[model samples]
Target: MKHYIYLFTLVCIMMSCKKPYNPPVTTTNYNYLVIEGLINTGQDSTIYKLSRTVPIGSAIANSPESGATVTIENDKSNVYALKEIRKGIYAAGLNLDTTHKYRLRVKTTDGKEYLSDFVQAKDSPTIDSVQYEYTGNAENIYSYTHDPKNNTRYYRWEYQETYLYYSPVPSYYIFKNNSIVPTNADDETQVCYISDTSSTILLNSTAKLVQDVIYKNPITVVPITLDKLKVRYSILVKQYALTADAYNYYQNLKKDTENLGSIFDAQPSAAATNIHCISNPGVPVLGYIAAGSVSQERIFIDRSDFYAASVGVDYSYCGGAVITYKATQRTPYPDIITIGTDIPTDSLVAAPILGSKDSLFTIQYATAACVDCTLKGSNKKPAFWK
Candidate 1:
């Protein structure tokens, strides 16, 4: 009887036990800013991105101060004030020139302050020349090569362009292998690069004869008297940024490049345009035409406008790359030759035509000759033959 009573008492004690304490859940907030753009107005402009630094432990985004003020300036008198484009993107009117040093300062909408050390922009190097040649397995494409004879000089390019055409759809056709291709042919603008190596060396050379020879007998096109292209070159400035900062800067520049897709971005088309006239007095011949048997006087017409820009910094400097600009032609260039020079006098004498803005193209150091830089001599190599 006593044992039974003890068991019943133990059961009551077990049922009366309590659970552990629990705490209330809490939440935090954090925010971060991302900047992705470039200063390519051809003049001076500074792009400054702003955002609140996000915290690691917070799930909520921080509310950035809306009335923030940012400023960028160079050692010279040039100064630019940042204007808010979006919630976190701030822009300034400071023009971009590589000859000066720049510093960035920010004042948040709530009066918070941020600053960046002085960043020096590098001067533009001379371009030897801008030249192109046939490339690829079938030699169906043309490319640019750079050839600054002086090893100490460097260069980059940016194009201002306009695509001129007229139609209900603003498109046109270019002949390829005896076939007509309909493309957007719309007026637009953007920045592009020379991604091939062979094209790079060719781009840097200043030899006009080399360019003439290549254009006379293009790798892809039918080498006829009418097959000519107009090409021009200009001096461009090279900039420097730290290695870690380059990737971020490139992404931003690309974003701005994507915005140049408007119909009004190119020049207006005229019913009558100037073609090469035979034997004009007082005018120097720019190019030669390839006829059935004999070469004649004809101006070369560039179907695509090209540009190149270089970017680098002093500390642990990295080489630059090339960018190209064109309308709606998306053909690949397998083998390219680029010829360029930094000398202002040797550069082509043309400015960005108003109402006819060509897209910008950039070329930096990364555009080197191919590991196997072989020219297709009469062997009819697949890469050099059409």
Candidate 2:
């Protein structure tokens, strides 16, 4: 009885001590203009993403700044306009003169203008290769590069990974007219290619080394059980040349966005940027703009390579277990061939009931996500796919 009384007192104290804690960053509205992108002098398109910072507790991830007139201004009085392809994304293929200096200029819908410091066009060295290797527990994908001229000591990289994934079960029929019918001849529902871009900053430097060479910097890690290993996968790595100031800015950004997690971790610091608001000198803008040509390299990985080592990959979570539905006299035919709550897989066969006036049919139904690959990714094949 005494122990129960002590436990009750402790529980009451614990419940009473609980209170909601709100941080300044979460409650404070510190929305500021954020610019991301570089002036690409290479064959690739130069793209920019403009957004506004949001509170930590806000439901939105980013607030895009649209209807902005963005341009690339050169020191020689030449200006190239960038068209807005998406909400806040601006892009254009600039035939920039390598001898001239360039800067980014932005005009917001709210009549605010921003500009970056004029910078020289730096040419990026070609990547040596992008390859993947099994690392016991997972696959490590890496990129290699070197600047023979030693001009590009600082570098940054970004990658796009595409993988061929399939549904748990292939559906040859589709649900139509309240019944099952053969899928269209041109439709390919079982196979698809999905792609994703790198979100974290990838930066490297060889300033301290004797030669400006980086060998096999870890670019991506693929889990052994990922669906990416279930079939064919490819990664496209793009490299950019960066100045020492730009490198330091990205280092600060990495510390701010990707570093802080626990109390023992490094605290967030102010990120450096070359961008400034021309309209209001005191108004702060986030981002670093540099004029550079991008270098690219691509590599493909085959599932057969993994199978040789008896490694396994899974896509079973797509769903499992289909139900066989049968029609009866009470319910002669279902207007919708759904099995319980499961969606119709559009697979069925008519079986005449022995000595019965009504014709009975059995239907197989599975989750729509399981039967149709299009539910998860585009059914169309990627343009670069073999």
Candidate 3:
């Protein structure tokens, strides 16, 4: 009887210690407006990207909020209208007074209105230098800047990177008129340029420091194994001044979106936005707008900057195969070198035969992605490229 009692007690303890607890399924059926971008007070054109945020289970994050009337309003009642250059993207050139405060006014296609809080245009200090440090397996790019007035304490950064790329096997020929032909010297698919924009949220604050100085604030890191470091690389860094409120909002957003999924991490929370829906005050908006003048700087890094051991000689899976010319009793001198029709699909590289003599003998072939730089990037160099 005592054994039975002990067994029952143990069973009860085991039942109470269930491993998984599933909360009830909650659905957010309403889409919320998400406004992004800064109002540039300088000579540069100002652009705002508007979109709608979907549910947590949504496969797509950005549902563009189209057909919206966007405007910039100042304290003196001066209004500047922005035209929709593209779907969900509104742009305008504004030369507003630096002393006056500015705010954004937006009216959605659904007839709902929204407004951003009035903010003073903060001036971004010039970036003193953008330097890099080599660490274990990666290179960290850092930015240095300071505000002489010590008033601009908060900062934000965005960057665009362009890199030169080369095809593993240079394509010197083109298939035309049912024959292999040599391409123009300049038309060879040997080199190209590719560019990418920064998507991560980068922010810094010097509010607690004695002087408004940001020294060696790391912006981004490039792993040594990344293809971006395979050749000449250039980065254009744009810095923005932000208010304390804007800084905190971005910080919260970074934590909510980028810092999740860790076991010890806190649960994701809603990020606060300055823009609000006037029609339905209870509806959540998903962005913060700050008025500021941006400062930009560009730097280039060559392959020589990389450590010898870190350089990647084989960035792509590139190899060549030879397809021999075959003549049979049934078919005399069949065209086995013609890509997409005669050559085995696996052996066709879209490029012409590796050499003119190969057309008479066995044809040397490769993959287009491995031999054609145009498949990855443009052969025309960017105007800013040096």
Q: Report every candidate's CA lDDT.
A: 0.32, 0.81, 0.80
Which 10 residues in a row give candidate 1 its minimum summed lDDT?
A: 287-296
Each prediction's TM-score versus the true structure: 0.28, 0.84, 0.80
- State the lDDT at 205 in candidate 3: 94
On lDDT, the leading prediction is: 2
lDDT of 1: 0.32
In the range 1-386, model 2's lDDT, one tens digit per residue, is 99999999999999999997755565666779889888988777899999999887788997998999999999988889999999999999886777888999999988989989998889999899888888666779999999999999999999998888887777776554554556786566678788889999999999999999999898989886677777888889999999999899998899888888777878887777888898999999988999888889888888777544433454456554444334653253354443323344555566776887655566555666666666667777778786
Which lDDT tens digits does candidate 1 get at residues 272-374? 1111222332221111110001011111223344321321112222233333434222222212322211101111122343576653333222221111111
Of candidate 2, the 10-residue stretch with the lowest lDDT total is: 332-341
In candidate 3, stretches whose alpha carbon ends up further than 4 angstroms from where it belongs are 1-29, 54-62, 173-188, 324-362
Considering every candidate listed, which one attains the maximal TM-score? 2
Worst 10 residues of 3 by lDDT: 340-349
**lDDT tens digits, residues 131-234, model 3?**
88878677789999999999999999999988898777765754546654556766556788988999889999999999999999888898767777788888
